[model samples]
Target: MCSILHIIGGVMNIAEIGQKVAQQRVALGISQERLAKLSDLSRSTIHHLEHGTLHEIGAAKLFKLLSLLDIQLKTESEVTKPHALEMASRSASVSYKTTISPQELEESLITGKIEPRTISHLATLIDELPLSLIVLVVKEISQRHKIPPKKIWSHIYSWANQFKSPRLAWQ
Candidate 1:
Protein backbone atom coordinates (compact mmCIF):
# COMPACT_ATOMS: atom_id res chain seq x y z
CA MET A 1 0.00 0.00 0.00
CA CYS A 2 1.42 3.35 -0.98
CA SER A 3 1.16 5.72 1.92
CA ILE A 4 1.69 9.40 1.28
CA LEU A 5 4.17 11.40 3.34
CA HIS A 6 4.48 15.02 2.39
CA ILE A 7 7.76 16.56 1.26
CA ILE A 8 10.60 15.90 3.68
CA GLY A 9 13.02 18.75 3.37
CA GLY A 10 16.61 19.36 4.53
CA VAL A 11 19.84 17.51 3.78
CA MET A 12 19.88 14.14 5.50
CA ASN A 13 22.63 11.57 5.29
CA ILE A 14 21.81 7.92 4.61
CA ALA A 15 22.04 7.02 8.28
CA GLU A 16 19.62 9.75 9.25
CA ILE A 17 17.24 8.68 6.49
CA GLY A 18 17.42 5.11 7.69
CA GLN A 19 16.71 6.28 11.23
CA LYS A 20 13.58 8.10 10.10
CA VAL A 21 12.42 5.05 8.21
CA ALA A 22 12.96 2.92 11.27
CA GLN A 23 11.03 5.31 13.47
CA GLN A 24 8.13 5.39 11.04
CA ARG A 25 8.03 1.63 10.86
CA VAL A 26 8.04 1.32 14.63
CA ALA A 27 5.41 3.98 15.00
CA LEU A 28 3.18 2.08 12.61
CA GLY A 29 3.72 -1.13 14.61
CA ILE A 30 4.87 -2.94 11.52
CA SER A 31 7.28 -5.81 11.71
CA GLN A 32 10.33 -5.82 9.48
CA GLU A 33 9.24 -9.08 7.90
CA ARG A 34 5.83 -7.65 7.11
CA LEU A 35 7.30 -4.49 5.63
CA ALA A 36 9.77 -6.52 3.59
CA LYS A 37 7.01 -8.72 2.21
CA LEU A 38 4.80 -5.77 1.36
CA SER A 39 7.63 -3.91 -0.29
CA ASP A 40 8.99 -7.00 -2.09
CA LEU A 41 12.24 -6.55 -0.18
CA SER A 42 14.05 -9.02 2.02
CA ARG A 43 13.77 -9.01 5.80
CA SER A 44 17.56 -8.67 5.90
CA THR A 45 17.25 -5.55 3.77
CA ILE A 46 14.75 -4.08 6.18
CA HIS A 47 17.00 -4.87 9.13
CA HIS A 48 20.09 -3.40 7.50
CA LEU A 49 18.18 -0.36 6.34
CA GLU A 50 16.80 0.26 9.79
CA HIS A 51 20.21 -0.21 11.43
CA GLY A 52 22.00 2.09 8.96
CA THR A 53 24.35 -0.77 8.03
CA LEU A 54 23.18 -1.18 4.45
CA HIS A 55 25.83 0.04 2.04
CA GLU A 56 23.30 0.64 -0.70
CA ILE A 57 20.01 -0.50 -2.13
CA GLY A 58 18.61 -0.14 -5.64
CA ALA A 59 16.66 3.06 -6.19
CA ALA A 60 13.57 1.13 -7.23
CA LYS A 61 13.70 -1.04 -4.14
CA LEU A 62 14.30 1.93 -1.88
CA PHE A 63 11.44 3.84 -3.45
CA LYS A 64 9.15 0.88 -3.07
CA LEU A 65 10.01 0.51 0.59
CA LEU A 66 9.62 4.18 1.29
CA SER A 67 6.31 4.27 -0.52
CA LEU A 68 4.99 1.49 1.63
CA LEU A 69 6.24 3.31 4.70
CA ASP A 70 4.66 6.62 3.61
CA ILE A 71 7.91 8.53 3.22
CA GLN A 72 8.35 10.79 0.23
CA LEU A 73 11.76 12.31 -0.41
CA LYS A 74 11.88 15.84 -1.71
CA THR A 75 14.76 18.09 -2.59
CA GLU A 76 14.86 21.79 -1.77
CA SER A 77 16.79 24.62 -3.43
CA GLU A 78 17.90 26.17 -0.18
CA VAL A 79 21.52 26.16 0.88
CA THR A 80 22.53 23.25 3.09
CA LYS A 81 23.71 23.65 6.65
CA PRO A 82 27.42 24.21 7.13
CA HIS A 83 29.66 21.32 8.02
CA ALA A 84 30.33 20.65 11.70
CA LEU A 85 33.91 21.91 11.49
CA GLU A 86 32.90 25.07 9.71
CA MET A 87 30.14 25.83 12.24
CA ALA A 88 32.52 25.25 15.13
CA SER A 89 35.24 27.40 13.59
CA ARG A 90 32.86 30.25 12.80
CA SER A 91 31.27 30.15 16.25
CA ALA A 92 34.67 30.11 17.88
CA SER A 93 35.81 33.03 15.71
CA VAL A 94 32.89 35.17 16.87
CA SER A 95 33.86 37.91 19.37
CA TYR A 96 37.52 37.00 18.92
CA LYS A 97 40.11 39.14 17.12
CA THR A 98 42.02 36.05 16.04
CA THR A 99 40.17 33.50 13.96
CA ILE A 100 40.41 29.77 14.51
CA SER A 101 40.89 27.63 11.43
CA PRO A 102 38.65 24.62 10.87
CA GLN A 103 41.72 22.39 10.83
CA GLU A 104 42.96 23.68 14.19
CA LEU A 105 39.52 23.42 15.73
CA GLU A 106 39.08 19.88 14.43
CA GLU A 107 42.51 18.87 15.72
CA SER A 108 41.78 20.31 19.13
CA LEU A 109 38.42 18.56 19.33
CA ILE A 110 39.79 15.21 18.26
CA THR A 111 42.81 15.36 20.56
CA GLY A 112 41.08 17.09 23.50
CA LYS A 113 44.18 19.22 23.73
CA ILE A 114 43.50 22.91 23.13
CA GLU A 115 46.47 24.99 22.09
CA PRO A 116 47.39 27.97 24.25
CA ARG A 117 46.77 30.38 21.38
CA THR A 118 43.30 29.02 20.69
CA ILE A 119 42.18 28.86 24.30
CA SER A 120 40.17 32.07 24.09
CA HIS A 121 38.45 30.98 20.92
CA LEU A 122 37.62 27.60 22.39
CA ALA A 123 36.29 29.29 25.49
CA THR A 124 34.03 31.44 23.36
CA LEU A 125 32.71 28.34 21.63
CA ILE A 126 32.00 26.60 24.92
CA ASP A 127 30.40 29.70 26.31
CA GLU A 128 28.22 30.86 23.44
CA LEU A 129 27.75 28.22 20.78
CA PRO A 130 24.46 26.34 20.66
CA LEU A 131 24.41 22.86 22.10
CA SER A 132 22.93 21.39 18.94
CA LEU A 133 25.92 22.55 16.92
CA ILE A 134 28.23 21.23 19.61
CA VAL A 135 26.52 17.84 19.43
CA LEU A 136 26.85 17.78 15.67
CA VAL A 137 30.51 18.68 15.93
CA VAL A 138 31.08 15.99 18.54
CA LYS A 139 29.37 13.38 16.37
CA GLU A 140 31.44 14.32 13.33
CA ILE A 141 34.69 14.48 15.25
CA SER A 142 33.96 11.20 17.01
CA GLN A 143 33.36 9.37 13.74
CA ARG A 144 36.38 10.93 12.03
CA HIS A 145 38.73 10.43 14.96
CA LYS A 146 37.48 6.97 16.02
CA ILE A 147 36.75 8.29 19.51
CA PRO A 148 33.48 7.84 21.38
CA PRO A 149 31.13 10.83 21.46
CA LYS A 150 30.80 10.44 25.21
CA LYS A 151 34.49 11.13 25.69
CA ILE A 152 34.24 14.26 23.58
CA TRP A 153 31.15 15.40 25.48
CA SER A 154 32.98 14.82 28.76
CA HIS A 155 35.75 17.10 27.63
CA ILE A 156 33.22 19.72 26.59
CA TYR A 157 31.48 19.51 29.94
CA SER A 158 34.79 19.93 31.73
CA TRP A 159 35.63 22.95 29.62
CA ALA A 160 32.22 24.47 30.15
CA ASN A 161 32.52 24.13 33.91
CA GLN A 162 36.06 25.42 33.87
CA PHE A 163 35.10 28.41 31.78
CA LYS A 164 31.99 29.05 33.85
CA SER A 165 29.91 29.29 30.70
CA PRO A 166 26.47 30.84 31.04
CA ARG A 167 25.07 28.78 28.18
CA LEU A 168 22.29 26.50 29.41
CA ALA A 169 23.49 23.75 27.12
CA TRP A 170 26.69 23.41 29.07
CA GLN A 171 24.84 23.44 32.38
Candidate 2:
Protein backbone atom coordinates (compact mmCIF):
# COMPACT_ATOMS: atom_id res chain seq x y z
CA MET A 1 0.00 0.00 0.00
CA CYS A 2 1.12 3.57 -0.71
CA SER A 3 0.53 6.31 1.81
CA ILE A 4 1.52 9.89 2.46
CA LEU A 5 2.18 11.02 5.98
CA HIS A 6 2.28 14.59 7.20
CA ILE A 7 3.51 15.59 10.64
CA ILE A 8 1.81 18.65 12.08
CA GLY A 9 2.52 20.66 15.20
CA GLY A 10 5.87 18.88 15.47
CA VAL A 11 4.12 15.58 16.01
CA MET A 12 3.09 12.64 13.92
CA ASN A 13 -0.20 11.03 14.90
CA ILE A 14 -0.27 7.28 15.39
CA ALA A 15 -1.85 6.58 12.02
CA GLU A 16 0.72 8.65 10.16
CA ILE A 17 3.56 7.01 12.05
CA GLY A 18 2.16 3.63 11.14
CA GLN A 19 1.92 4.62 7.51
CA LYS A 20 5.55 5.73 7.62
CA VAL A 21 6.59 2.41 9.05
CA ALA A 22 4.64 0.57 6.40
CA GLN A 23 6.15 2.66 3.62
CA GLN A 24 9.66 2.05 4.86
CA ARG A 25 9.08 -1.68 5.23
CA VAL A 26 7.65 -1.94 1.73
CA ALA A 27 10.49 0.15 0.30
CA LEU A 28 12.96 -2.29 1.82
CA GLY A 29 11.05 -5.21 0.25
CA ILE A 30 10.50 -6.66 3.68
CA SER A 31 7.46 -8.78 4.33
CA GLN A 32 5.57 -8.59 7.57
CA GLU A 33 6.81 -12.03 8.59
CA ARG A 34 10.39 -11.14 7.80
CA LEU A 35 10.09 -7.83 9.61
CA ALA A 36 8.60 -9.56 12.62
CA LYS A 37 11.44 -12.05 12.67
CA LEU A 38 14.09 -9.39 12.21
CA SER A 39 12.62 -7.07 14.84
CA ASP A 40 11.92 -9.88 17.30
CA LEU A 41 8.21 -9.08 17.14
CA SER A 42 5.18 -11.10 16.23
CA ARG A 43 3.77 -10.98 12.71
CA SER A 44 0.44 -9.90 14.10
CA THR A 45 2.16 -7.04 15.87
CA ILE A 46 3.84 -5.95 12.66
CA HIS A 47 0.57 -6.22 10.79
CA HIS A 48 -1.31 -4.20 13.39
CA LEU A 49 1.39 -1.57 13.45
CA GLU A 50 1.48 -1.30 9.67
CA HIS A 51 -2.32 -1.16 9.45
CA GLY A 52 -2.65 1.42 12.23
CA THR A 53 -4.91 -0.93 14.15
CA LEU A 54 -2.72 -1.14 17.19
CA HIS A 55 -3.92 1.03 20.02
CA GLU A 56 -0.51 1.65 21.51
CA ILE A 57 3.04 0.47 21.19
CA GLY A 58 6.03 0.67 23.47
CA ALA A 59 8.65 3.25 22.57
CA ALA A 60 11.38 0.65 22.56
CA LYS A 61 9.53 -1.55 20.11
CA LEU A 62 8.71 1.35 17.83
CA PHE A 63 12.32 2.55 17.99
CA LYS A 64 13.57 -0.92 17.19
CA LEU A 65 11.23 -1.21 14.23
CA LEU A 66 12.29 2.17 12.92
CA SER A 67 15.94 1.38 13.52
CA LEU A 68 15.58 -1.79 11.52
CA LEU A 69 13.88 0.16 8.72
CA ASP A 70 16.45 3.00 8.91
CA ILE A 71 13.71 5.57 9.44
CA GLN A 72 14.72 8.60 11.50
CA LEU A 73 12.20 10.98 13.00
CA LYS A 74 13.03 14.65 12.73
CA THR A 75 11.54 17.74 14.33
CA GLU A 76 11.63 21.07 12.49
CA SER A 77 11.64 23.72 15.21
CA GLU A 78 13.18 26.88 13.68
CA VAL A 79 13.33 25.80 10.06
CA THR A 80 9.64 25.27 9.34
CA LYS A 81 8.30 28.76 10.21
CA PRO A 82 10.24 30.74 7.61
CA HIS A 83 9.84 28.01 5.02
CA ALA A 84 6.09 27.89 5.52
CA LEU A 85 5.84 31.69 5.28
CA GLU A 86 7.88 31.70 2.09
CA MET A 87 5.73 28.95 0.66
CA ALA A 88 2.56 30.83 1.60
CA SER A 89 3.86 33.98 -0.10
CA ARG A 90 4.76 32.01 -3.20
CA SER A 91 1.34 30.38 -3.25
CA ALA A 92 -0.32 33.76 -2.92
CA SER A 93 1.70 35.17 -5.83
CA VAL A 94 0.56 32.54 -8.29
CA SER A 95 -1.50 34.90 -10.40
CA TYR A 96 -1.35 36.18 -13.95
CA LYS A 97 -1.39 39.95 -13.65
CA THR A 98 -1.05 40.86 -10.01
CA THR A 99 1.21 39.25 -7.44
CA ILE A 100 0.89 39.75 -3.74
CA SER A 101 4.17 40.41 -2.01
CA PRO A 102 4.97 38.71 1.25
CA GLN A 103 4.82 42.03 3.12
CA GLU A 104 1.47 42.87 1.56
CA LEU A 105 0.09 39.48 2.37
CA GLU A 106 1.30 39.75 5.96
CA GLU A 107 -0.13 43.23 6.30
CA SER A 108 -3.44 42.20 4.80
CA LEU A 109 -3.64 39.21 7.10
CA ILE A 110 -2.74 41.22 10.19
CA THR A 111 -4.86 44.29 9.51
CA GLY A 112 -7.78 42.59 7.74
CA LYS A 113 -7.12 44.77 4.75
CA ILE A 114 -7.55 42.99 1.43
CA GLU A 115 -6.47 44.93 -1.61
CA PRO A 116 -8.84 44.60 -4.54
CA ARG A 117 -6.17 43.24 -6.84
CA THR A 118 -5.00 40.58 -4.43
CA ILE A 119 -8.42 39.23 -3.59
CA SER A 120 -8.25 36.41 -6.11
CA HIS A 121 -4.76 35.47 -5.05
CA LEU A 122 -5.79 35.45 -1.41
CA ALA A 123 -8.81 33.30 -2.24
CA THR A 124 -6.61 30.84 -4.07
CA LEU A 125 -4.28 30.77 -1.10
CA ILE A 126 -7.16 30.09 1.21
CA ASP A 127 -8.44 27.31 -1.03
CA GLU A 128 -5.17 25.59 -1.87
CA LEU A 129 -2.50 26.05 0.78
CA PRO A 130 -1.86 23.00 2.90
CA LEU A 131 -3.42 22.98 6.36
CA SER A 132 -0.03 22.65 8.02
CA LEU A 133 1.32 25.65 6.12
CA ILE A 134 -1.79 27.63 7.04
CA VAL A 135 -1.32 26.77 10.71
CA LEU A 136 2.36 27.68 10.57
CA VAL A 137 1.68 30.93 8.79
CA VAL A 138 -1.02 31.85 11.32
CA LYS A 139 1.37 31.05 14.17
CA GLU A 140 4.24 33.06 12.66
CA ILE A 141 2.00 36.00 11.83
CA SER A 142 0.44 35.96 15.29
CA GLN A 143 3.80 35.92 17.04
CA ARG A 144 5.31 38.62 14.84
CA HIS A 145 2.29 40.94 14.70
CA LYS A 146 1.18 40.46 18.31
CA ILE A 147 -2.27 39.42 17.13
CA PRO A 148 -3.99 36.56 18.86
CA PRO A 149 -4.07 33.34 16.90
CA LYS A 150 -7.84 33.30 17.25
CA LYS A 151 -8.03 36.72 15.61
CA ILE A 152 -5.89 35.54 12.75
CA TRP A 153 -8.08 32.46 12.35
CA SER A 154 -11.15 34.68 12.42
CA HIS A 155 -9.68 36.70 9.57
CA ILE A 156 -9.03 33.53 7.63
CA TYR A 157 -12.51 32.30 8.36
CA SER A 158 -13.93 35.56 7.05
CA TRP A 159 -11.86 35.30 3.91
CA ALA A 160 -12.93 31.74 3.46
CA ASN A 161 -16.55 32.75 3.80
CA GLN A 162 -16.17 35.66 1.40
CA PHE A 163 -14.35 33.56 -1.14
CA LYS A 164 -16.43 30.43 -0.66
CA SER A 165 -13.26 28.44 -0.27
CA PRO A 166 -13.80 24.70 -0.81
CA ARG A 167 -10.92 23.61 1.34
CA LEU A 168 -12.08 21.66 4.35
CA ALA A 169 -9.46 23.31 6.54
CA TRP A 170 -10.91 26.71 5.78
CA GLN A 171 -14.49 25.48 6.01
lDDT of each: 0.79, 0.80
Residue pairs of candidate 1 with colliding backbone atoms: none
TM-score of 2: 0.61
lDDT of 1 by residue, 89-142 (tens): 988898878899989988877677888889899898887777667777887788
TM-score of each: 0.52, 0.61
Could you say which candidate leads in TM-score? 2
- Per-residue CA lDDT of model 2 for 138-160, tens digit only, reads 88888877889998788889999
Runs of candidate 1 exceeding 4 Å displacement: 1-82
Tell me which residue pairs clash in candidate 2. Answer: none
